[model samples]
Target: MTRIALATASADLEARFRAATGGAFLPLPPAPLPSNPAHLFAQLDGAPAPDVVVLDAELAVDHALDLATLLDEQCPQIAVVLVAEHGPDLGLAAMRAGVRDILHPQAEIAEIQSVLDRAALAAQALAHTVAPASSDAPPATGRVISVLSPKGGVGKTTVATNLAVGLARTAPNSTVLVDLDAQFGDVATALDLAPEFTLADVVHGSAARDSMVLKTFLTLHETGLHVICGPPSPAAADTITSEDVSQLLQMLSLEFRYVVVDTAPGLSEHTLAALDRTTDHVLLTSMDVPGVRGLRKELDTLAELGMLTPARHVVVNFADKRGGLSVADVEATIGTKVDLRLPVSPATRVATNKGVPLLQSGGRDPVTKQLRRLVERLTIPETVTAQPDPDSRPPRHGRRRGR
Candidate 1:
């Protein structure tokens, strides 16, 4: 029987998880809570290492971080998953403290189980990779890309959706697009695929850690792109914290070669958590004055917070010559070079409105070609491509901003 341990402070939550896990649930050992969390190491010194530790973030953020750090130092093999009520920012903090996965207080049993299963697999994989005989082999590290924007209505979702499809089309490896915007996500509608299971379904199920619930929840697009759509109801968003997002990303990274995350606008907890887990952050903005100004402010904030990394790239979406601001002027104002510029195409809006991806129409359109080139530049390192000049002239802006 699998030995699972629940370290949550809530009796109701413990009972629910116990009922769901049945006989596999292991009774948590009696351990006194330390008034000073710095003594946590001493308190758990002789205690048997849990296969999985489900910590409650409500107890204390600092305590949670301390516990995660202690667990990593004392029992590096043990997998830690945190449960919190806040958004992904907390999850990112927990991750920084050494937690492998995170979940919200209201996370479904199935979702918890999926996280547990993935954690177990990751632990086992680590053990095997570290074995004396296999020590010479290099470990596998997957790529995690985050799609972000400072302000809303900048076509971040469209860019994310098309970029994901474009990557899947260009690369032979498996790709998964996760809608992290739990409140107002439209990834499913954009792809025109109605999935039988949403992320909510996976979170609510009672399947074990090794169950197929997670794999089954993903909806495969016509372009062979797999997506995990956000919850249907906005009210459900409150239940999804930063920790949950972190856990989901960690699990997805194991199975996918490329994971494209569509984040909500602004620097919410969820957005921060996504950024923390991401290997690359794609900053999306338009040619509008307010958009450029907002992007600059957001980038500055990220830098101030020490969150900006070398992998962060600025992507200019809906680039048109007729736009009021030229590309150079936009870049000069923003104080950042535009890494990739996606041309405005009328078919993009039509495709989105009709519930289809632009890539599905064909790979021949100028916009599609640019999108494909963007993906190529991202994936291939040896191939040197010319970077667009920040001072370069912008295409003429048309009557409507073609997304």
Candidate 2:
């Protein structure tokens, strides 16, 4: 059964909930609580978190909206649903704000039951996937390669765009790139594609309401690499919660062979949620003291969050031995060996200015070669032997930092 936390400003919530769910749900508090994220989190802050939180419309809309965003960021495992006076009217905004279901306050009993059933099913599947299973478990079916940086202005979007185009050379239409920088994202600007529909539109539009409806929302690049740009407006970003990211990544993984994500600086809630479902992490940084050190600290946080088990790669962008720091120095600082080092090239800046990716720009420059090599590294199989091979041993405390 699905453990559901019911919150409302209505006093007769229990009586009405029973009539709606027919005593089927395992409601937390065994009664109604204040319809807010803090109160709900206080009640169920420990192990065995509820699968969903059903918010009633009696509470203030702004408060409920804030709670929905907070709950998704703090407890992504638990989905959120809201009962509104005009459920259908809320539509895209409701889903964009991390609501799995928006039901009319007087919604049908069956409709309520169906919504609860979906939450329960998703929770059960995630539980099975996230349980502390054997470390030797086989690799997952799909790979989510996330490009992140602890500081801004590190060429993260540049690397992400180039890598996607490089991978598309081998995978054709099977490669996709996603821009997760909600506040200030330049993937669309870099690629020079005027996408009338962006990630925010997908999240707030009817297309994102279902996983199977993947079309027109993603702008197709000339290299056959699909692109999912960030929100056109900063205000639209507030509506996209972490859970929405998880669902989008899951669906994208199903549709594409390679799901390349370019995230904002540092670990935002949306990035962390995507990391949980990711298979490969491309941590990007510049060859500067603050930039590399900040990435090192972010690595520690990811370790504490049990994110080191996946394939982790450190990419040092704008490398110049004569400038600031060398490749070896970067590796020593980040505590992880540099997997790819991109040289500072004027071609990269020109490509970005012209709305074209480095690889697709068709320049036989050093940056283009490195971009191809990056994809080649990703294509290699990660096979392990039963015994240690000193010659090719993996990085120490790098793959499984927390363990």
Model 2 ranges with Cα > 4 A deviation: 1-140, 382-403
- What residue runs in model 1 are displaced by over 4 Å at the alpha carbon? 2-139, 203-212, 383-403
Q: List lDDT for all candidates, in order.
A: 0.70, 0.73
Q: Candidate 1 at residue 207, lDDT?
A: 15
What is the alpha-carbon lDDT for the whole of candidate 1? 0.70
Residue lDDT tens for model 1, 68-155? 7866654566677777776657766777787888777887878877877877776676556544464667655467788899888888
Give per-model CA RMSD.
15.8, 12.1
Per-candidate total of colliding backbone pairs: 16, 0
At residue 6, candidate 1 shows an lDDT of 64
Best by lDDT: 2
